[model samples]
Target: MVYQTDLDAVLDFPILIGDIGGTNARFAIVVDSYAEPREFPVLFTADFPTIDDAIQSVLDQTSLLPRSTVLAVAGPVDGDEIDLTNSDWVVRPKQMMKTFGFGDVIVLNDFEAQALAVVALGEAHLEKIGGGSAETVGSRVVLGPGTGLGVAGLVHAQHTWIPLPGEGGHIDLGPRTERDYEIFPHLERIEGRISAEQVLCGRGLVNLYRAIAAADGKEAPFSDPAEITSAGLERSNPLATETLDLFVTYLGRVAGDLGLIFMSQGGVFLTGGIVQKIVPALRNGVFRAAFEDKAPHRTLMAEIPVYVITHPMAAVCGLGAYARTPGRFGVETAGRRWRAR
Candidate 1:
């Protein structure tokens, strides 16, 4: 529902916020407008029957009535139901409001919340991947490969920052090398197509390993992605190492393409579980080299900054920020050009 006044202004303090993903659901209570929030233990989505069940467990901790709640879900937020991309829980804002007796509830795409969090992150929360200093007056893009790939953009508009969210992971993944072309056909295609998500997510890690092994006519060990990553990181398997290398390289290429598409001179932020686990591989120059390999605009690519978000609760931080000041986020209005004040 649209609020008459800004929702941020009217919402009560100690707001409940969440970043719900395929594997885990993270929740926090913002007690003060500017203070660090009280967080709950990470809840696995598979353990809960519905989103309501998960929230109920959190409420059981304090037994207090919250003024409002904002949930950052790992999928598109549309119409009445917010269907999770990788989870079974279907979150309905209006239904949730009625069930919980909440004054308001806001649902956002997980990456949309991450895009908001970009403004809240400090130097300590960011690990630089490559590029020069971020542009102070340009767009910023944030994408993450976890259970799924998420893409979003943040831009200043009308004295506020607005989030641009889309399903960019579903786009066809283009190959840039002979090796990539050789392995493309082996990927477990989605809907008879090879989308970026099929090669950039947790399952995608396994897909890469299998395809690489098949191309070389060798048998792949470690049936799952975790085992493959373990073998790759432990330096026990050459095939696994090569698989991860290709994965990171392709990720860099996709990230660079996104940088160009959004003109994200401000920066490109990478988040989510998979990138966090494979950070060492990402910093070894392969990823950066591929990122800046763009023809003609390679110079521009080098100038655009890149970062990996180390903060785990970044989405929660952004949701809290929006909860405190709705009008400041520029999400309520549209088409207004922003100025740096």
Candidate 2:
């Protein structure tokens, strides 16, 4: 059901915007351009049977009729197909467009959209974690650890921001402490690979909990991450507290390494569910300690600003930005060359 492609002005087109994580899918109808959208509707995917159904429920939030949509999903989007890494939802882009009655559909990797959004954000939105201020427009890195660890980077060139995706989270994790060394073997016993995702994601915290508990010769406590976090912060469980400490330390190490590799002089933005779960811990743990631990170069790296995106719909804003310019990927260079005229 294709509409008139010649809608030149896009005046009445209410673009449906969304940020689809594995657990929730937030839907909104942008009455105007994405730069300054007004009305919004958010939803949880678990409450619906399919993505289509979720969108339908979102539409019911108001009388606004949507003509197009840009969905940001937390998973690999190759060709026209996408399968959420943490959920059972699978979608075909073309099919979704047809079903939703939209002439065109924009589907992007949620992290990629996040990288794009870094270009559009203003000062008031981002919360500074550590480090001083950001460079004007140098190389930057964005990382999120939710259901899994998502890695993406953006470089400025040709007056545009280009996002680069990487499977770096799956890279082998290395420990830098005596406690880490003890925990590493236990982690390896459980996951075998001990990938960054194993220690950096929501589940990764639980993994750290198990490993640390075992290292302390204690049995694995709870089955849920919330339980572990609760025990650590509220209940004051010794094992959970120690595990959270080590997890933050290792995360700092990984973030520090990533910063060096990317040479992110602009800044590094830390986001995702786990970080939100332990915001206070970030101030106390390895997040900055490990980040500034890079010897000799440590002082230089410390100059690089770091922030945590507190906005819940950050990725949605990113997806909305992606809908405006297509094919912004595939031409990024280490020297910061973007695919612009």
Predicted model with the maximum TM-score: 1
**lDDT by residue for model 2 (1-341), tens:** 11112232132357777778877777666665444554355666788878888877777777877777766777766655678878878766667656767765656667876787676576666777788678887888888888888888888765656677666678778776676788788774334667888888888888888888788788885878888877776637888887777777777878888888889988988877677777788886467888889998988788888877777677766655544433343322222111111
Using Cα atoms with residue i matched to residue i, what is each candidate's TM-score against the true structure? 0.93, 0.86
Instruction: Note the clash tally of each candidate.
Output: 2, 0
Error of 1 at 112 (Å): 0.5
lDDT of 1 at 3: 25
- After superposition of all CA atoms, the RMSD between model 2 and the true structure is 5.5
